[model samples]
Target: VALADLGRLPVTFATVDPVALIRNAVWANSRRAKAQSVSVEPGQLPSTTVLVKWDGARIEQLFTALIESSLRYTPAGGRIAL
Candidate 1:
């Protein structure tokens, strides 16, 4: 997922390129369904911020959960991102 801290608060938001996010999610999910492969599509990050307000702790927690889940199911040659 794409991450940005636009609000200047301690918080950072999870902001993905909408089109890339959808494509990546679909590709990752499909791979998991078949060969048990996992991969995260590379994010096309913007030079400027996209999302504004978010909780730092929440974002960390979100990534933690995601990584944990991916580790549990993803096999060799699979990929995940922060």
Candidate 2:
């Protein structure tokens, strides 16, 4: 799923700990594929704002989809970020 889609969700909002989410996404993705590696870095935005609002479960699903997609195309030793 695209970040834009997540942003468009009515129940999703800006997270205070975006880095933690990124870390979790990476870790979860790494567990699913042995040939791929995952990493996350802090990103910057113009300002902190709630672009969308969603529950935690939906966010997890979105991340899972993203990781699966990455694993499909990424070569061994390559990295995927969320």
Candidate 3:
């Protein structure tokens, strides 16, 4: 569905917390990082939720892609704070 949306589909925008998204992205990619012995965790986050209007799925995909790319380059025993 996400791939199909790439064909100029209208973005489903809504209020979302970016910090929560970051944490979720970290969790989603943690297993791969563990397999490589690299620590993947969320950095310090704001105490209050930061809301924004955007396509949540696309934002998540972007975060996941960035983290996966980092995992590909980071050495074993390295740390990545998203």
Candidate 4:
């Protein structure tokens, strides 16, 4: 599952916007939160471009997995922060 989640990437790296990326990923999983009765919260991260040259999808998967992991360990009404 981890391998599939981090499926592919280009041979070359590119600058990435982590906030936007995580926002989209969280949005995509919003229904999961409702179903699990847990909240995945994001802090007030700045708009300052926190750029990084890395596997964007992998990084997103890493965070997404962390959130999901929290759901498993946390109580039904618990919260996971990013």
The C-alpha TM-scores of every prediction are 0.41, 0.51, 0.86, 0.75
Q: Identify the runs in model 4 with alpha carbons over 4 angstroms from their true place.
A: 1-12
Scored by TM-score, the top model is: 3
Q: How far is 66's C-alpha from truth in model 2 (Å)?
A: 0.6
**Which pairs of residues collide in candidate 4?**
none
Candidate 3 residue 79 Cα shift, in angstroms, is 0.9
Question: If ranked by lDDT, best first, what sequence of candidates would result?
Answer: 3, 4, 2, 1
Mark the 10 consecutive residues where model 3 has the least summed lDDT: 1-10
lDDT of 4 at 2: 55
Q: Write the per-residue lDDT of candidate 1 for residues 1-82, one digit (tens) a residue.
A: 2344455445446554444443444454544434555555434655554543454456445545565577577786677653
Candidate 3: clashing pairs of residues: none
Candidate 4: C-alpha RMSD after superposition: 3.8
Q: What is candidate 2's CA lDDT for residue 66?
A: 76
Q: Residue 10 CA error for candidate 4 (Å)?
A: 7.4
Better of 2 and 4 by lDDT: 4
Cα error of candidate 1 at position 79, Å: 1.3
lDDT for model 4, on a 0 to 1 scale?
A: 0.76
The parts of candidate 1 lying over 4 Å away from their true place are: 1-42
> What's the true lDDT of residue 16 in model 4?
88
The whole-model lDDT of each prediction reads: 0.51, 0.58, 0.90, 0.76
Which sequence of candidate numbers ranks them by TM-score, best first? 3, 4, 2, 1
